[model samples]
Target: MRKTFTRTILSISFLALMLTASNGYAQQNNTNDEGAQHLVKWNVAALLLKNYSFQYEQAIGRKTSLALGLRFMPKSSMPFSSVLKNAIDDDQTWNSIKDFKTGNFSITPEFRYYFGESVFQGFYVAPFLRYARYNADLPFHYEYQQNATTTVKDKMDFNGGVDTFTGGVMIGAQWSLGKSISLDLWIAGPNYGFASGNISGKKTLNSMEQDELRKALDEDFKDLPLVKTKYTVDGNGAKIDFDGPWAGLRSGLSIGYRF
Candidate 1:
């Protein structure tokens, strides 16, 4: 709920900037621009990864623009299966992670400064803030004592999501195709941020089962970067808590239309 409220406020703030830029202020600079002061672009690079993303840019100054972008991917099979197996040294761990299904949604608001003769054409630098959320599901395995002389090995279904906020800078170049056509290349972007999440399974468990499940999590998720894995267990269910620093990179090839 807090995440939703934060995003809502950002959306409204962006809309206010849009209104101001598109009104008298935009016309005041129309003669100086003599070119398109607005552009909408589709990120083709993201499509290659089965993600859909789009951006809207509005010129707010002679050499500056403000843009808002959104990226989305529906929950499905994890990507790059081969890379996953090769990257992790543990075959058992790889086997377990191989079945994870994931998806994400993100929003980025950018402020750009163009160093070219025109606003939408030439090299530019942009500082941006991004808010992203990711959802995932995995089958977690464990062993528990079911009877005096018997041991049960089983897997429980786990599902949950995370929310993160980050800030970054990107450098890129844009070319005007003709009257209203454009091409934008996002060369490099790196961001750092904090993250928190809860992943859990909904099922009744005995004390012994819960204890064993907690031990399994400690072993399986120990490698998660920059964070300590936390486990919560009860008769109601089991949960994994995540809180840590996150780093990310962004790059894209986009096609745009100016108006």
Candidate 2:
């Protein structure tokens, strides 16, 4: 975990430095006598565009440009589920199920390779890469109790962890609405998926040890009665798979400056 976190931070910082260095060069070139002839631009607002368009002008420019910005999604969600339902309910016979909710935050670094000055951004497609994380906590608690019934009562409480990986292709156009503002609007996805969850519970049970009571409860516990058991349960695991389009959106506006 520590290594992963460290590497992610380092990658984001390195991308940021490159963006800054490129901005310095673009600004220097913009001051030349033939301003319109220069192909460089440095504007923070244009950097913030959430979408990109694939047009001849924006595509004709340089193919290699580094974009460093934070992908802000007031919300990043992942599907979550757990197998430890028995830990939460006191009566396993009459089980109740609960769904888990997930969320996370990540720093997104983008590199764009324009195809050249052509209708389809010089190329038929632009491939992009993104690294994201999904971290969340799910809590469950329940208690069952009975007296004189030889009936059993159980209660459990737990929490778990979830992680994810997002990767996909974005189809877009670059609309140069003047030099300061540009719009890149198109849908992106085929988002990849990876996640895991954990749950732990502190359990306590009390009930009659009578044979009659035990028999009534069920055959699963017929052998033991007038029983009292206390246990600690914990689980941690992970998973990986491919997801459909829009399965998870890391989409957001990125405000960038040219120089």
Candidate 3:
């Protein structure tokens, strides 16, 4: 799981750099400066992965264009919820079965303007204002045996979900790739921290409930060591702020029909 997460981050960063390098080429080489003749092109692609997949893009113009993207993944993607449920459902791992599946999604749309002479070929920097949305739910199935009677039983299920939004500044570079395509790379973080809010299908677990669960597990299962899990969730009901520069990175190729 750690390896998978690390690979995802690395892949995103590498793609972003390649796109920016391509855009830099277009800026330094293109001699044509006629603003009226410059053209804008759009490209889009879909991502298919284990738990998270989505579509993203790159737009090229004379000096500015837009960046829009979206992604979907499940919080239960890594199986943390299963561990949590284990503490509540049974004392042993195989004694009781707990299953939860969640869905996560985000959308980003922004206006980005280049800094150099050309849009596609210029070495440009863009300051963007963007928004994101996240939603998730964990449906659980539990089975256990009564302590005193040794009778076994199972519960129907439980569900949990949350929603949030964030606004921030993103700085990126656009490097030109030949005459028709541009490579893009960027990093972004929130200004005043991130704000987020969410609703769960089942009763939500507060911070205290979660902490108690953790403490109980540590005391009861000290012999069985497990990695600690930490989460950084910020945002109000509609909007929030965040900390970090490389929130995400994206890359793609585009075709243009210049007039």
Cα lDDT tens digits, model 2, 204-229, are 32333233222333443233322222
lDDT of each: 0.82, 0.36, 0.43
* Cα lDDT of model 3 by residue, 109-194, tens digit: 66666666644443444433334444433332233333676644322222333334444555555454454443444443342223
Once superposed on the true structure, which residue ranges of model 2 sit more than 4 Å away at CA?
Answer: 1-61, 72-102, 115-124, 141-158, 196-259
Q: Per-candidate TM vs. native?
A: 0.78, 0.40, 0.45
Clashing pairs in 1: none
Model 2's number of clashes is 30
Full-model lDDT, candidate 3: 0.43
Which candidate wins on lDDT?
Answer: 1
Candidate 1's residue-wise lDDT over 32-131, tens digit each?
Answer: 3365789999999897777999999999988899999999999887777778788899755665688888899999999999887657756799999999
For model 2, what is the alpha-carbon lDDT of residue 99? 35
